[model samples]
Target: MTTDLTAFAHSVFEAQPFSRFLAAELTDVGPDSAEIRVRNRPELQQQHGFLHGGVISYLADNALTFAGGLALGGDALTAEYKINYSRPAIGETAVARAFALTTTRRQAVCQCTVHMLGDGEERLVAVAQGTIVVAAKD
Candidate 1:
């Protein structure tokens, strides 16, 4: 299959105004998966000196949305999503990986795992699952 998940991620990232604010980068993408990384900049830090939960959640959502788009091979929109935080993310970079778990004519189900990388180890920070609604092509 001629799946260009990376291209789809880049397009989605570029289309979102807030994505630029997050400074997220699409590091890896495949037929049914995508990964994103965001540096721990000063602006992204919270009061306790850890990355904010919103930032990580945004990254995770984007990754999952992109993965769903790749699976459907069409325009998609997030129907619903839920995220659970496991720990505070205190690291130099936050990484999110997402994959499509299932797909139907109108919806795609995706899962995303977010991790904080620091001290040479990656710690699970959050996880999310979402449904993306795909629209018919013109």
Candidate 2:
């Protein structure tokens, strides 16, 4: 099931042009959680040499939706989200881990934490909470 879920997550991640461009990888996906990781690069940094806040936010939002989808049993979209930065993200890679906090038939409340990994350690960079709704069938 883990392999299947990870494959499903990868396929969905691959379909997003922006995510693909960022070289984001869906490292894990399970019954109520998901994780994404992206390597740091020059283009993804800001003037201060920290990972851009927008990039962190993107990871948080996407991870939250993926976790919600796992809990809800289908694809999900972020209805809304709020993020708080704890520190500048200075690292070789950024990882986002998310889990469903609560779930109902139509939606899930999820939380995520973004971490910066480098120097044999991880630093908490940001945290987020969001509402994710079932995606409309196309």
| Number of the predicted model whose TM-score against the real structure is largest | 2
The ten-residue window of minimal lDDT in model 1 covers: 1-10
| Cα lDDT tens digits for candidate 2, 5-86 | 6677678888999898899988888898999999999999999999999999999999999999888887789999999999
Alpha carbon deviation, residue 84, candidate 2 (Å): 0.2
What lDDT does model 1 reach?
0.86
Superposition TM-score, candidate 1 onto the true structure: 0.90
Would you estimate the TM-scores of all the predictions? 0.90, 0.95
Each prediction's number of clashing residue pairs? 0, 0
What C-alpha lDDT do the candidate models reach, one value each? 0.86, 0.93
Q: Between which residue pairs do clashes occur in model 1?
A: none
The lDDT of model 2 is: 0.93
Residue-level lDDT of model 1, residues 1-138, one tens digit each, is 354556655777778888777777888877777888999988898899889998988988888888888788757778899999999998889999999999887788999999999899999999999998785566
